[model samples]
Target: MSTTQSDRLRGLLEPLVDAKGLDLEDIELSRAGRRRMLRIVVDSDEGLDLDLCAELSREISDKLDETDVMGEDEYQLEVSSPGADRPLKEHRHYVRAVGRLVKFQLAEGGDLVARIVDVDDEGLDLEVPGVKGRKPTARRIAFTEIAKARVEIEFNRKDKKEEEA
Candidate 1:
């Protein structure tokens, strides 16, 4: 996508999302079959629900109808929250992923899979899982040392089961 078009779309939609108490995570315009698909990913500290997504979609559609930002093309607008595997790109993303398992690619070298225990402007405190019945170890990783990071989905986590109980 062109930078100008992306910027314009952000300008038009950011305010609407902010008003709804959500962060606009991303926007993508692509061709799906014969129709143009506009995907708007939103997120909130408290998380998002289906009802909120429906309301935001309606509001965004209304705003788009009043503007010429998308030109004359007939497009389908999809409003949704970021998925579980979304990359941890911002400080807020890290903060939100606290207590969740994450896989990190270090800039210096190597990879680490750990549960996020805490986060700050500079870095994160992670609880690295130990092997062979050993206890978990705490480690600190600076943001600068992280080449990339994403939340890891845990299907059979003990913590999750405990939480349910």
Candidate 2:
């Protein structure tokens, strides 16, 4: 869709989203067969639940119906959270991932899979897992050093408290 339409939609929806204590992360309008699909991704620091998604969807639908923002085209609206494995782009994304395993593609070199121990405005403290029974080593990486990063799902993870005990 056109940038003007996207910007208009953003302007129209952002306030509604903010009023509900969430951020509108993204919006996409795409053609699906004869109908258009408008997907809205929303999130909050407290995270999203099914009830919130349903509520937001109803609110957004009502606003759109009143605004004439999408012309007269028939469209489907889907509202949801950014699922696991979304890219870590903003500082808040990293902050939310502080206790999770992440795969970082370094600007200077290769990939590193590390558990995030901490995050600050400048960089992150990661615990690089050791091979075999060796102790994990701590590594500091500046945000500038990262080209790409995403949270990695761990199935057989051990709790930090259990490990300490």
Report how far off residue 51 is in candidate 1 (Å).
0.7
lDDT of 1 by residue, 16-78 (tens): 999998999999999878789999999999999999999999999999999888999789999
Candidate 2 lDDT tens digits, 21-120: 9988899999989899999988888899999899989999999999888999899999999888889998988988877899999998899999999999
Q: Show where candidate 2 strays beyond 4 Å.
A: 1-3, 158-165
lDDT of 1 at 90: 92
Each prediction's whole-model lDDT (CA): 0.94, 0.92
Model 1 regions lying over 4 Å from their true place = 1-3, 158-165
Top candidate when judged by TM-score against the true structure: 1
Q: Name the lDDT value of residue 26 in candidate 1.
A: 98
Cα-based lDDT at residue 95, candidate 2: 86
